[model samples]
Target: MVTRIAKCTCGQLQIVVEGEPLGVGVCHCFACQSRTGSVFAALAAFSPDYRVSGRATDYIRTGDQGARFRFRFCPVCGSNLYHTEEGEEHRSVAVAVGAFADPDFPPPQDSVYDCRRHRWVKLPDGVTVYEKDPE
Candidate 1:
């Protein structure tokens, strides 16, 4: 089993994920853009086979689709570590890819909410693009 660690910028909160990610993707939705303070947000979803250390603050957000997500971020540095869907029996935790800080990490295979993607931004070839969230 391959283990990888993802931590907040201040090293306050950390997550250790076992095995490979279930899915790696980028979201161009406005909510993601605002949450990451970047044009888009890159994330990797992994199963519950992960562990977390240190305390984190939680912020619950309701998505465009009305799905609620509980964002867990470092209370000190305020770096978002991961988020999980609520009330859906969701078993996957989506971690911010940037927190991994590995340039060699796997590239994103899916791009969602492409309709809001910046025109100047180009995605890797062969990525599955969705104009909006796939319901």
Candidate 2:
């Protein structure tokens, strides 16, 4: 089994996950761009089988479709760490790929909200593209 660890900037919060991720993707929705302060947000989804350590502060926001996601960030450095959808907090999690700071982390395999993707941003070849999230 493979294990990977992601930590916040201040090292005040961490996540440990064993095994490969369910998916790795980039989101270009306006909300995601705003949340990440980047053109897109990269994240890796994992099964419920993971562990979290240290303290974090959470913020919940409702997506345009009404689904709510709770984002947890390190209180010490304000680094966004992870998030989970409402009612799925214990069944799944999405961690920020940048939080890992691993050059070897798997590349994004999917792209969501491509309708909002910046024209200057080019996705890697072979990526599964979606104009919007899959329903």
Candidate 3:
């Protein structure tokens, strides 16, 4: 039952996610890269009921699969907060790894969209890599 906490740069926004993450991974979609301003976006997915605190602004966007997803962020400091999506089997949210209050969070278990991965980024060996979502 490990709990993870995430906060904004000003500490004005905070959220507590109970239990270990459902999964951890990196997304190399162009949208993720652009929003994170990096090679890819690291994410920790959690169950839908995870407690969320502070005020967050949510923006909706359609993923490559055409499913609707929401991105939450701190309105003031613009810190990326989390993401949520609904589907047939899973309803969950993904917290930005960089927003974690702890710096020792584990690295991702997989790297998705390797075809889109930046030329300069090197992924660790043996990680499950995907050119895109399997489905």
- Leading candidate by lDDT: 1
lDDT (Cα, 0-100) at 30 in candidate 1: 94
**lDDT (tens digit, per residue) of candidate 3 on 2-69:** 87788878777777888878888999999898888888999998877677778888888888788878
In candidate 3, position 121 carries an lDDT of 92
TM-score order of candidates, top first: 1, 2, 3
Model number with the top TM-score: 1
Regions of candidate 2 where Cα sits further than 4 Å from its true position: none
- TM-score attained by model 1: 0.96
TM-score of each: 0.96, 0.95, 0.90
Point out where model 3 deviates above 4 Å.
87-90
Question: Compared with the true structure, what per-residue lDDT tens digits does model 1 show for residues 1-135?
Answer: 989999999998999998899999999999899999999999999988789999999999998889999999899998999999996535888999999999998999999999999999999998999999987
Candidate 1, which ten residues in sequence have the lowest lDDT sum? 84-93
* Superior candidate under lDDT, 2 versus 3: 2
After the best TM-score superposition of candidate 2, give how far the Cα of residue 56 lies from its true spot, in angstroms: 0.7
What ranges in model 1 sit over 4 Å off? none
